[model samples]
Each structure stands twice: as structure tokens, then as C-alpha cells.
Target: MNLLLIAALIITSIAVLAYIGSMVLQSWLYSVPADKMPLRSFVTALLAGGFLTLWCWIDTKNPGRYDTLFSFSSYDTEDFDVVDAVKKVGEEEKTIRYTRRSVGTKMVYMNDQNQPFRKADAEGAIFALIVTEKDKPVRFITKLDKNGNFPPGEIQYREEGGKRYIDDTMIGRVNRPGTLKVIYVLLLNFGHFLIWTLSLWLVMNYALGHAISIACCLWLVITLLIMPVLFTKTRKQEKVITPQVSFPSVNDPNLSEPEPKDEEKKGTRQFQDSNGNGIAILWIGSAISNS
Candidate 1:
């Protein structure tokens, strides 16, 4: 099997989808037309995310865009010292040095390169990462400060693999990155629509009438009125998008294509309108005499 080709296709598909999704999200956030967003988004993701995707493919096992946005904190705080007993090659335990910074309540540890060692908490205990241990993952001791407590914050307790085991030791307690990303996408894209529609409905119904049915009726009308502007696509964009895994098939006779020239010749299609239209209505038993 051609794994490299497969990986490329997968990554390209994801990058395009991610770009479109993020574009729609931006539209909702910025009150821009969603259709007009894809062209620009498609260009940027293919050009920018393409290189990052390649780098990740070369350096890592999985395929994904290494977006710096979700990867880092706003800024690092002043560094503090942390001590760890890492196992040596033979049978000795050596002190591994690290610098820690507190991003909010979470303590981040960085190596000599000043880069974060643990991208995520669960990744803490990989054998490639570990004490008097041979061919085993390194073990870590609970850290304490001058006050003799575990730094008076969350432990982020590590286990066999680089995973965070919290008070609810079960894996169910931890939310996966993919799940979190989905949630964030939904909330950002549709959150404004929901907030405004509900708020307007609530206020109008309360002031005018006092019933669930009345509020629901108001909500329906408000939805239709507001949808023509914010949180909806207003017009189509005509810009050509940059490359992102598109292979046009020239030999396909069954493919359906839009005939813009024909549509344009008709202008705004009017009903009444034409014999074809009246016949279609008559066929469907909805035709009535003008008189």
C-alpha cells in the first residue's frame, strides 16, 4: 500500500476541511459572508498549513497541522527550578534539570531548548521520556516548594504514558483534544445566532405575552428576520481558490455542471411568468385562472 500517498491525501483533506470550518467560524464571529470566506481560507491553509503539515509528517508519526495558536500560552512566566531523578543507562539515577513556568494554574516544564517537553499532560510517562530503570519509562517524584506542599496547585499527576491522571483516576474524566476542538468549533460558529435569537425572543415574549407558545412563535419570526444578515451567507464569492488536493477529471461525461450563461439570460426567474411555469403548476394541480 502507498502509505505516503494515503497520508498526503488525508492531510490535504483535513487541511481543506479545517480551513473551511475555521472560515465559517470567522464569518460568524466577524459578521462576514460565509461564501466569501472559503476562497481566502483555501488559499492560506494550502500555502501556510501545507508547509507545517509537511514538517510534522517528516518529524512525527501522525499527520496534522502544527498550528501555533492552540499550542502555546499567551506568554511564559518567570522560570522556576524543578528537580527530577531520571534513570541512567546502566543502574544509576541522575538528576535531570528543568525550568517550570505557571500558565494560569497549570505548571509547564521546559527543557534546555526552552521548548515545552510535554505538549499535553497525558504524554508525560513515555518510556522514551524515563529512573534505576532499564528499557523502562522514567519515574518522577512529587515536587514540593519551600512551603513543603505540592506547589499549592494542580498535580497533573503523570502515569506510565504521558497522560494526566487526576482525582477521577478513570480515563473518562479527561477530555480528548479532538472532542474539545469539535466543541469549540460548534460554540464559536453558532453561539452568536443562538444567543441573540433566544435573548430577543425572551424579552419580546415577556413584555408582550406570557406563554411558552407565544415565545416560541416570536422566536420563529425572529429567527427568519435575523437570519438574512448575521450568522448567514449573504452573497456568493467568485475568487479562485489556491490548490489544496484538487484533481479535475476531464473525461467524466456523467458529471453535472452549472450553466451560468443560460441562467443569466433569464435574469431573476419570474413565475406567471412562462408557459413552462404555468404548465408545471398545472401538472402539480396548483394552477388557477388569472380572472
Candidate 2:
């Protein structure tokens, strides 16, 4: 990736991982509105937000961190799951999908970086991972559905030559623009700030010994660069599908406000402006990083 893009990622990550996440946590957990919250609340929420993110991160067991001094804290990883190592040895510059055909493992191990073969810990199926050197458009998979429930999947078990085998596949779930599921995910995206903050600390520690690397991770600088764009975009997308809601004065009764557009009323679609909270930058960053 180019320095410009990397710079963008560091900036985007910090904004969501701190400012925005802090604001939400303080408002919900502390019952303090964002405008009235203090600086320390932001920092404290930043720490608290990452508690879940850190738990999730550690759940991955960091299989690739094995070579470092933190190896003892890391767990064994497969070649397909390794991240830091590069796959420049082969002539194939094209993208690839890797898999294993072992007794209990299906397709696994895209030979990039140290990504390891995924074994069927229980029952498994055509475990899919599509990777490419060429950058192309992709989509986001919301792990949670609209009601914050796990999406459906198919996992079948069988016995092959006395060896237990498992098979699985993801049932498709799309959170398109204006969908409640999309909004839910957009809301959950703030939790990612904690993970980013934790990552920032680890990265800063390493870059502290290297001056040039330090320049790449100035979060405050990048946030300044991005804030204006966010401001303009937010204002533009604040429009409502229904007529503008006019809450009556406390003296007036509040009832079913108004009917939405036909599309929204049909239950087929709803209107939600970009619903951006200045966090889509992280989406771009993650997509870029994966590429």
C-alpha cells in the first residue's frame, strides 16, 4: 500500500477508536451527553471500549506473533492465518483461494503471509477465503443481523474412513444502504475504536524506536484532515424520508407522526441517509489492509 493510504488508515482508525467511541460510551454508560462530557471521560471510555475488543483480539490467539518476544503469549497458527509474512516467492501475482483436503480439514491455507490451513476443529465444510494481489471491490459481512442475532449458517458433520469431518458455509446476509441491519452494524462499528486504540499503543511502542514510522501514525493530525469532510457529508445526509418530524411543544400530544414514503411503508426499504458517524473511513482502511 502507498504511504498516503496507510496514513489515511491510521487517521481513520484513531477517530473511530477514540473520539467517536468515547462520545457514545460516555453518553450511554455514563449518561452524559457528548457536548457536556469532560476530556477524562473520553480517555476512560476509550479504555473501557477496548475491553471487549481486546477480548475479541485475544480470542484470535495471535497465531502470527509467535516469532516475537510475545510468542509465549501467542498460540500456534496455521500458514494461511499468518499476517506479517509476505508471499513474494511465487510467480503468481494473481489472487488465490487456498484450502486443505486433509482427513478433517477442507479447503484452507491461502499461501500468503503465514495464513495457515484451517482445520475442522469440529464439523467443517468448504471453508472459503478469497484473496488476491489485485485490488478489487468487496463487501462487508455483518456478523450480526438486524436484531443483533447471529446470522444463519450451514454446518454438516460426517465420518470419512473413521475420521470425523465437518463442513460449513455462510448463509448470505446483506446489509445494504438504508437497511436496519446496516444501521445496526454502523452503530456497532464504534466499538472497533477500542481495538484500534490497543493496536495504536502496540504500534507506537515499536515505532518509538524508529523515527520515520512515527510520522505515519499521528492520529490527531489525520483527524484534523478528516473532520471537515465528515462535517459536510453529515449535513448532506441528514435528510429524512418522511416529512420532517415536528415534535409539538410539551403542551401538544405526540402521536404517530406521519406515514413514510410508499417504499418505506411497503416494508421493502427505508430511508437512511449515509448514517455516517465518521467511521466509514475504517471500512475503507480495513478493505485496503486486507487487499
Alpha-carbon lDDT, every model: 0.39, 0.35
Residue 255, model 2: lDDT of 54
Each prediction's TM-score against the native? 0.19, 0.17
lDDT of 2 by residue, 50-136 (tens): 333332233234222211111122122112221111121233222334443233545433334435533232222222223221363
TM-score of 1: 0.19
lDDT of 1 at 244: 94
lDDT of 1 by residue, 214-262 (tens): 3354335433453232122212335788989966688776565756686
Error of 2 at 188 (Å): 26
